[model samples]
Target chain A: MHETAIAKAILDRITDRLNNLHHASNATAVEVRVGEFRNVDPESLSFAFDSLKKEYPTCIACALNLELIETRALCKDGRHEYKASADNAYRCPNCGSAIGTLVSGKELDITKIVVSQNK
Target chain B: MHGPTELHILERLLEDNEQLASHNQEHFDELGLLAVNLMSAPGAGKTSLIKSTAKLMPADCPIAVIEGDMVGELDVERLREDNIPAYQISTGRACHLDAQMVAQLLHTTKLPDCKILFLENVGNLVCPAEFPLGEHLRIVLLSITEGDDKPIKYPVIFHNCDAVIFTKSDLLPFCKFSLEKAKDAISSLNPAVEFFVVSTISGDGLPQWRNWIVEKANKKISHLHIGL
Candidate 1:
């Protein structure tokens, strides 16, 4: 549901980058890291990107690379780190503590973008 | 004849949103206002809570509300009926209210002068949690009728909140909801979150809820003065 908004943001950011280039170039791919806690579905994001990219000619042929990250947290005890999943009740396996300091799960960042020089 | 170039840009996709949220926060802070974001599932009694709490707030600390919904201004109308200054943001298809939507409202409309502002986010547990609307406090409402497993099922919303209000406490006898189970689940997700069991109909637990808000608002004002 919110994927459409994210898709638009991605397209807007990439298009801005594309527009800033001195030489003419076509965007080839965009890589984004999505975290588990973001409530974003990969398939839905892909569908939204594909459907919306048509409006932006520079991104018409661009590919989206979504790196889905699992939720990982450090325990309050500062001794244990664990992956949060349904099985573990999203708590630390050793201390049974909730996310004290989140290590990686909330990232929704665009790490890389590939573009081909046009002759 | 160069090949594809890989640009290294490790940037948050929602950076624009984060910036706008800060801007909105600055606006609120500058006005000596404590903005609170209220979120919950559809029909979880967000509006009801606001109506009840507005009456409880002191005369000096006036209250303003910004109601967000996918469509319609019925909630805003309800608040206005009580002579409260309220604005409605009708988000056509979006499930959540982003900082941009709020910024647009702030830029276009003039908000009433008030010490406390309540942003009733679009009634959605999932998407609303992802978008911060420049609020000083985030509160989630879970009615007993919604069942006790909601905190576990929708952990993101429950985890990100500063407080959780168990609404519709009057219906507790009729439903199979376990208050202890719900509190335990939420505590696991958020250890420091404050909890309140409020029944707007019966006027139960309203004093505690009102006191919590007043204390937080006072703290915000104090922080503002000391430039914390």
Candidate 2:
């Protein structure tokens, strides 16, 4: 349910922000970033967004885009630097120690919004 | 209207959920609740521990549980049967539970009276550790049957946990489980994490576990009252 909760939360916030902006007649597009480590299913999120859109007709034309970020692991083995591969299982290549910390992938954010209003 | 589209970047899509999670944490702090998010592989005895803990808690101390699963409400049903207030959050196709889901469940359940809340996250080692549910404590359970290399294999989970509960301890004698090695591996990853060896079936080491939880809960509650 990671994507379900995340998608709902994103859409709910978008609606709130749009409503607060007093753009009752305008549609908007929102982009969100989800890290590869977050293990979110983008397709499921799209499905959820479609369902939510039905309730908020004003957001019928709004577009939701997901940007997936991939992260890797970094560790040191006896003064030697090493990085793990892109695979799910992360471990030190040299020492085989799985204590390597995440270098990038675990991030989820709503970066920007595009609102379409009549001029 | 025919038009060429412009591309825009909207980051922090989960900001709203994060805000709600922050609010939930504030509420938890106010009540002095030590919310523990328990994550593990399937059949790791998370629910069993919940039952034992609930039974051991003092009558005045209120405890509640939120069970996350893919489909059935079996955990919820079992908890309710034991006279505990439990809620089920179905993720459908989702693999793990996040802070927003916990926040929504907290809002819908209206369980302000509880001093301690247990979120039994969906049985998964990888994804659950990635999302912060604003829990004061994160306990990862490992059974003797799961093999001793779990910590070395799943260091991320151990690194994020505040404590580790080695359940099904009674099977240790029969299985090739090495408690010492397991502790060493977990310690190598998270030296500060406390450990509790318990068996729900044998009722071993449960009282000490209960006491530890109660003491922490009481301390948190006192701190909250002082802040007020």
Candidate 3:
């Protein structure tokens, strides 16, 4: 539902960056890392990105690259690391102890944009 | 022909919103206020919870509100009728209240003197969870009418909030809302979250909710004092 806004934000930021480049005319792809802990739906985000890209002539050929990160948990006792799931109550799988720390899985960032000036 | 180049943007997607949120956080800290972001799906009794809270809070306590909706100033007007200091943010088309809109509100609205600020976000279990609007605590409401599978389906929102309030408790007997099932789903997602079962109509469990807010506010103030 909010993917359109996200797409706009991404394109706007890249567009701003594009303005500063010497001869960059368009982008081929934009890469983003999304985490399992985030509520974003990558499919919806991609669709929104595709739909909104038409407004920016510089991003007409742009494609969205979504890399999803899995949610992981570290045990408080420093003995275990496992995929975090609601089934385990986010606890360490080996010891059944408390969650020590969240390792990754909460990322929502754009890593790189593939841009070019070539026809 | 120039080769395609990779611009390593490596930036947070919501950087602009986050920066403004930080500014709002600093502003709140300077004013010795605790901002709570209250969220829920449509018809979750968020407004009724506020009205009940107003009745339960001590008369001496200073509280203000920022109401967000897709469009309309109706809620702000309703709050003003009760003499509460309030501001309204009509999102127009936005589904959630982002930090930039709140920053805009901060710039335009002169909130009255208050120790606690309740930001009633636009009704959504999904989008609002993605944006952190400079709040000390995030509370999400779930009415009994909504069903028990919400936490399991929307784990991101369920797992992120500090607490969850089960509203419309008075109608529990008439509905199929299984509290145990709901709790099971919630505990599986977030074991440490505080839970409150409330009914604004009967005033079954509002004191605890009201007290929780006060305790959080006081704790925030003490933290600032310690920082000084």
lDDT of 3 by residue, A80-119 (tens): 7788777776666787765556687888889999998855
lDDT of 2: 0.73
Which candidate number would show the highest lDDT if scored against the true structure? 1
lDDT of 2 by residue, B21-117 (tens): 5677786787667787899999899999999888888987879888999889999999999999998999777777777778777677677578789
**lDDT (10s digit) by residue, model 1, range B44-68:** 9999999999899888778999999
| Model 2, TM vs. native | 0.68
Index of the highest-TM-score prediction: 1
Per candidate, native contacts kept equal 0.81, 0.33, 0.73
The CAPRI class of candidate 1 is medium
What is the C-alpha lDDT profile of model 3 across B59-155, one tens digit per residue? Answer: 6668899999998988888888888888889898889998888988888877787878999999999999888788878898999999987887787
Query: What DockQ does each candidate score versus the true complex, computed on alpha carbons?
Result: 0.66, 0.25, 0.57
lDDT of 2 at A28: 65
Q: How well is candidate 1 docked (DockQ)?
A: 0.66
Candidate 1 backbone collisions, by pair: none
Q: What CA root-mean-square deviation does each model show from the true structure?
A: 2.7, 5.8, 3.3
**Which docking class does model 2 fall in?**
acceptable
